[model samples]
Target: MFSIPLVILVPSAYGRMLLRLANTVKERSDIHLQIFAAGNDWPLEKVKEMTEAGIYKGFKPFEQLKSDFQQADAFLTVMSFEKAEEPFMKTSFTTKWLDYVPYGKPVFVWAPDYSTAYQFAHQHRAGIAVSEDDPVALVKAMIDAASNLETWQAACGGARKAAETVLNAEKIHTLFVDRVNHVCRQSQDTPNIDDLKELAR
Candidate 1:
């Protein structure tokens, strides 16, 4: 008797892909998707067309993101259509997941097992990760999340903690500054052209 509607916030580029995964649950009556995308990739007319055809409920503007996020139950983060064997899928992490974490929302990650993004979801326990190889697995993940409300709530809290500890912007900046300072010190310690010439002799 899960009554909360599952609202998934997805970029237009990812909305369709996620729909493929959601086909199993789209008509469930308790699930809804609010897709927002911008830029030349998704024109206004195209957005309208997708909705009219019932591809999704509709497209929203980026302006509505924060308000929409506040209303939504969960977030979605997906990778490109490539399968597990693709080289890029093995190492790349979708930054969208990090964005979702800071919101303290439960996320459903659709990525290959080899993807670092999938690994992060598992390691942090911030969200559920579904294997891209099995579409049914994705659907099952969604249903399980809906049924296990308490566990998902805890995951949301974990998401916020993981964001602060592992993906903090200030922490990243400090690491970058440290690397730059180390590089400068190494350059200063290196011999000048005259010293190099003498050593060669």
Candidate 2:
């Protein structure tokens, strides 16, 4: 197979900024961050120095995005939560989880609430969910997950399992069929307002 030079993990600027916030913790933490950005050239070396002793490597954005999740040994994600008055936080899902599907690597999520991804992770045992401001929690989770190879591999298996539950052509077809059936049922059951008013009067 043709292997590329490197994998580029390209998230939006908002995500990058969120990630930077995690780096505010003391350096030499268990979690190490690698950057692959094509936007304004910030001093990523600062990130490298803070995390992995200046081992900042990269390729293109697309490739890095893949390796960052899939081939990456692990991941740290920033997640939001579902508030009572507010809607579920958008960042709670982190589409990056989709990229990690191929590698089946375990993820360390930094989220503020119990979200869909958090539920998915627990359901499939695919990753560790942490509080967004808890960098210590993220690092500790990453370290523990890394140390347990069997557990990590199982998480990968679980990730693939999660995908199979939703990604198969047959599964999609079944969902479409079910949705159409429900819609048809609803249409049949929808009451005619005018007819009801006339009958009542």
lDDT of 2 by residue, 1-201 (tens): 111111234345434444554354335554445544443233666555533543244345565365445445665555443254124553345566655555655565656545666666776666677755555565666667678878678766776775677534467689999999999999999889998899899
Pick the lDDT winner.
1
Clash counts per candidate, in order, are: 0, 9
The TM-score, computed over Cα atoms with residue i paired to residue i, of candidate 1 is: 0.75
Model 1, 62: alpha-carbon shift in Å? 5.6
Per-model TM-score on C-alpha atoms: 0.75, 0.60
What TM-score quantifies how close candidate 2 is to the native fold? 0.60
Poorest stretch of ten by lDDT in candidate 2: 1-10
Candidate 1 total steric clashes: 0
Q: Residue 102 in candidate 2 has what lDDT?
A: 50
Q: Per-residue lDDT for 123 in model 1?
A: 88
Could you give candidate 1's per-residue lDDT for residues 55-104 as a string of tens digits?
44444544555676767677766665564335776766676665566677
